[model samples]
Target: MTAALFLTSCSRKIIPGKPVLSSTRFTTDSLPLSEIDVPLRINLKPLYETANKNVQTIYGSPGWPNDFEVVNCDTRYMYRFKRGPLMITAHANTVNFNFTGSYIIAGAQRICTGTGSNRIPITPWTPTCTCGLNEGERRVNIGFKALLTLKDNYDVSAKLQRLEPRPLDKCTVCFWRQDITSTVMDQLKVQLDDTGNEISDSLNRLNLRSPFQQLWDMLNTSIPMFGMGYLQINPEKLRLSTLYAQNDTLNISVGISARPRISLTKTVGYRTVVPDISDFNQRKGFSIFVDAVMDYDSLSQLLTRELYHKRVDMDKTGKYIIIERCEIYGAGNEKLIIKIEFSGPDKGTMYLTGRPYFNRGKNQVEIKDIDYDIHTRDLLIKTAKWLFNRRIINTLNHYSTFNIAAYADTLLSKVNVQLNRQWQKSVSTAGAVNNLQVMAIYPLTENLVLRCNIRGELTVRIDAFDF
Candidate 1:
């Protein structure tokens, strides 16, 4: 795939080779809340399923026809998403003014004031929730990166070789010779079966074989041995969204809607991580659109302020969002669960890079208006964050690269690939072994090509190599 080459980058941060942002999101940094209330409930099951399945499909899966015959792909790969690469450093301080002694008494301060008195003093657990963070700063990079690689089964050459039929003890076609020559010569009769049915069976068998092979041949012949070229993967989209520029756009787009499939065990190199709230305190959304080189420190800075510096938006009250958990997948596959928190839902749509009139750059290509509720709007924002995550960061995971295959198979000439994803599984707090399937496909070309005749569901399950 095209991503095979030029794949030497890190797999951390929302979008590698991009900028970091800040926000004025209200959070208690100095004091870790005894009970940190995370209002967002993340359904990682779908995200995990989508990502894991994609990893299998990308490597050309094994054993199965979709899998490669030869072990050409690297199975020990994992798709990881990170928060930031830009570390913030800052110096802040606070001074305590004064303190007063306090005492606690129960039942109207009934004190015995005697040596044999069974009385105790108590005080309410009241402490001024205050902290003076002296002007201090350290490099707290909010970026995230992981080591991941995509793999599949065997090589195509091997699969074809294995599919070839070998000789059998009993030849199904031998009866044809007997039927054609039996009644003619004495020598031919010696080889014929005792029953005259061989003659009839031969005719019937021939007729059936003709249509079957003919159909097979027809389908195979229809399969363009050539036309399109090598395929490519956009790990950015998390789906294989193949590129085929046969028309005016002069660029390839997704070709199929079939969900990419993969096995669980084939996937290797997994490393899980939770967000660092302490570090996240720095990404204040949208302050002044600046570059990464400037103000790379200040872990206390909000992400909203950070984005403002990038010129993505200019908002007070730090109009921004924080995606608690999301699966990184392809462009078109929306089979992911996302959790997002925004100061105001209005700015939620802007978190993603699409048409301003409508969000998600996708349908906006046609529809002029987009609508959403507060919760749904936040969900969309979370999904956008996931789509933005890419595995183009880690170097070690960047093994042999691949390009989008030019040729596609099937009547619709559909193609499926794994573009971008971060997959993993876990027994949820509710004890559900959930699966996540995420991918993207470029479905339209000039004038909407091949809109009909396409449908299929991709299934994926993780397996342990040792098993």
Candidate 2:
């Protein structure tokens, strides 16, 4: 009960002229630049160690004049103060340091006789001391705060908020309790100021250009996609978000403007130098628009394997044709043309054209509005009217779809390889692609192009940066 069984007479060979589609160029529209955000976590332990190494632990010496103070008729003191290791912490943009140490003071009550113009010491300076000469030392606490800011040129500026010192024990002189902590702290101000300046200078000299430049160059390089093609990130402008400190780490987000594309052949693009840091913008995640171009030859093969020698029984009226071969190519006007050759009641070739659209629900590229070529339609209307059945069109529509999920998964793997790797000796990146979906499809002369959107998150880490 096939269509070919009912044919009584031999039908004339139907050879229709191939459709001459208008020559139309396929051009990709200029889309807005995509943003790729990468979070950066810089370790601050090395910086703290550098600061601790450079800051002096010992302040005043026990000798006089240089590290001693004398108040006429009050007291004369000489002290030696030693500080413990620095304990550093940070929050927001400020770094705080606390140092606890012990101090020893040796002094005596002094009596000055005579007028202000002619003051004289009446007694020799034999002094009884507290926490000196084989005695325990008095403990003290030293605290400092540094407010950090970053410049456009990648310079770090640290402003000293304040330096405070408090002594745990008070000295008693001449049977009266006396507090000499203020005098000791005042005497140590100059040394504390010098230490603060040293730390700030060291912080200012830290350079980030080397690491950033390496990252920029890596982004500009081409990455190969297995069995597909090459992908270029094509990064442009770069910006950074506000800085935050967590424990001993500095956290920030670095964003770049990029236009990603896929090509069959490797392409080398112009490399630009890393520019100055831009204003801070608060944003998360990354969004990239990718133009994934595929060759027509590959597409033709894929379609041919599914449709070749496929028998289509149109209406079961003995008017059926077996699909011999098929080829897919662009038909201009943003359309795809599938040329099908068959044999049954008539032996000839026919062309079906349709517009390709992305089916988001199914994650596929499906063809719609499929119909015969003008010449094929005319020839079929006269010789083989059974070919005009809607079942043929429906069958073609069912099998014409291209599953995009597999292709998207391949692309995601390729991209993630580049996103997560070590770019330099001290810099490394980690990223993951959460989603990649086809937004549009275009049939071009040489390639079938898919415009896809990819979403992901990336992080860059610098293990060691010179302080």
Candidate 3:
């Protein structure tokens, strides 16, 4: 009778119920709203050169306007002006121009004879006398200021702040012995107005939308992350900061709102068109809430590689179990269900459940309160009491953890590669991730999601300015 009891106990087969656990809604209120500052640096030297070229073209050939009539009729003055190279400078969206040139004046002077009461004019005017003609052209300087602003439609508007003409050399009429430099400068102011208008118009016609659209297109796509997954920027809204000019370079910060994520597979979605420029809000750096995913299949393989075919002693008795295979999946109720198939004195399947939590000190995600499922406990109590020992439970719990710090490092490296690379000709990005730390963990039916906060600085560089 004792031998019969022993045989029955050894041959008893354990089968636990595999009841599906109800899913729980995992909500995280701390998931941050992402903000990325994409600093747009444009080479303003090209723009300045282009503006100067346009101005030169508008001025036309040298010795331009061989003669400009300032005062005609009885006491007339005709002026001729020549301009040198155009110099353009920009500071804080204000553009200034300096044109150094020379000028000459020639005109007839009025002649009167005798006293005022009985005066009679010898001639309506004396022979045309010139000033600064043979004595070399008199020096003059023209300066202008343009206040530039970004319009809502992305057009650049330049308002003429002030345009002044200053004559540096004297231009005295030979007979009149009067300096006409100020008078000549007054006549030249009209031409300066036209030049100012030309500049303003040129700036107003500048098309900034095309370049911004190109940047928008570049950012809207998915970027591949080696050994991790794909990153979708998922940009929502955008705003532009005021223009900053330094060392002949213009920098504009483009702030973006995004919901970024990492997926095990590439995600394809409808591409969004770039919207109009929004209100200006100055901000720096980036704060992103990124969902980093780990597929259950990958997690299972990682755990199985460490625990596969491992032998564990049940007790002092000769009885032992070898883990033939293991599978991990979400069992709902914020718990992870691990299924282990083993070969031992009793060959059967057992299930364990645990709540996963992040251990900040270890930088790991460890399973806590790990033990056999309720059904597994019931079956083990009846058939195989040896398998329900704490030693076995401890072994499973110890091996169920994953090092999140290492994963975060790998993820950052992969993401940085995509962030800091040349996107196309004359367009590139320079980015640095300050920190990417896991904030929360959620085990869903499909995969494990690690909600992370990524702080970084990103800048978009344009080597050439086409617009």
Candidate 4:
């Protein structure tokens, strides 16, 4: 009876030794993958208007004066004239001036007195007389054109280069009352040139420190707050790429190079100079590899909830087995090792080993070719009738899949929603998930690391100036 029992337990006819697990493996890692590209568009009208307002505030007061003197001279006589109190009024498209002042004529005076000094009556003579004249208001309009350029410096500030003034119209009083409007106009031209120079100086000295500081604050404090689940962008640098003019708008392109990380704190600051990106080729899209780590504790909880203590019928003889505990570990070379302990009619432990790969079409991570470990298979073969259950192996194979693609899609949706909510008024972002695949799977100290390649396109629209 003992010999018969041994034969029955070791019989090949009773339990199959090798179970073929049909699955596919991808060997090519050089497949061309798409990338995520972010394009930003900015409008320049608001910046232009704001600059105009700033210029007006500095020079538009009524007390400021542009003083000039004109000499009315002829072969017979010469008279010195002075004009003062020139006020400036600035508009968006032009600057207007009003000069209304008392002009004093000096250098020649009449010496004839009213026939009373010392009873000596001098002949009443109309000598060359120096007189004070009140010149009425003179209005002049100076038109200008504004140009913008990206200045090369440590901070890379924006410069407004004001071109030469195109005088729209000018009117000046005739100081000599002898058709000398040309001479008076000449003096006014000199004064207008000085005023124009002042305007140019103000414009050239405009500092963009506040705007850039606000941008840094938004990027570091406001935008990253929506990275649900610790996802964030660690910006290493921001570089100016290109600046140009299109129609009435100024177009600027800035290149941002950053890394995506999982963080819980806000850490960033403003930098004047960024890394050299001159050789960084601008692409419409780019791809990134992200490591989504599942710690042992979380994996343990998930597996417990899904599979622990589950029972499976093993054979038709009313024998069944229950899983007492389950555990997962990373095997090198993109594989997972799952160890499961069984209870019920028999009590034993088994190990499952298989390679995990990304199913691009389904957007999920599936374990393929799962089978019993060598030691577990040997143990099962040794005690086939008492301890081995084929249903347990089938059950483990059926449930050994991770839905990574769905998780990625859900993550993308959450990020997009947050971006829209945060930047709806000033900026807009648009993108969608294109492809996701597993690149590698490795073991960390206490976690299973999964690296995946994600590809998509992101477009950013920035309203630089509000209407």
Location of the lowest summed lDDT over 10 successive residues in candidate 3: 1-10
Question: Global lDDT of each model?
Answer: 0.19, 0.76, 0.76, 0.48
Candidate 1 residue lDDT tens string, 325-419 = 21111122221111122322232221221111112222121111122223333443454343222221111012111111111132113222221
Query: Alpha carbon lDDT of residue 34, candidate 1?
Result: 15
Worst 10 residues of 2 by lDDT: 1-10
lDDT of 3: 0.76
Better of 2 and 4 by lDDT: 2
**Compared to the true structure, candidate 4 yields what TM-score?**
0.61
- List model 4 lDDT by residue over 275-321, tens digit each: 33333234565475655556656665666567877988867768766
lDDT of 1 at 321: 36
TM-score of each: 0.15, 0.70, 0.78, 0.61
Which candidate order results from sorting by TM-score in descending order? 3, 2, 4, 1
Q: Which candidate is the best by TM-score?
A: 3
Candidate 1: count the clashes.
138
Clashes of each: 138, 4, 0, 4
Report the lDDT of model 4 for residue 461: 58
lDDT of 2 by residue, 235-340 (tens): 8788877778877988878888888888777878657788888767867789989888877777778777888888888887777888888888885568888888
For candidate 3, write residues 340-458 as lDDT tens digits: 88877777778888887888889898889988887788777776788888877888887989997887888888888877898888888888897987888888777888888899899
Whole-structure CA lDDT of model 4: 0.48
Task: State in Å the error of residue 215, model 3.
Answer: 3.7
Superior by TM-score: candidate 1 or candidate 3: 3
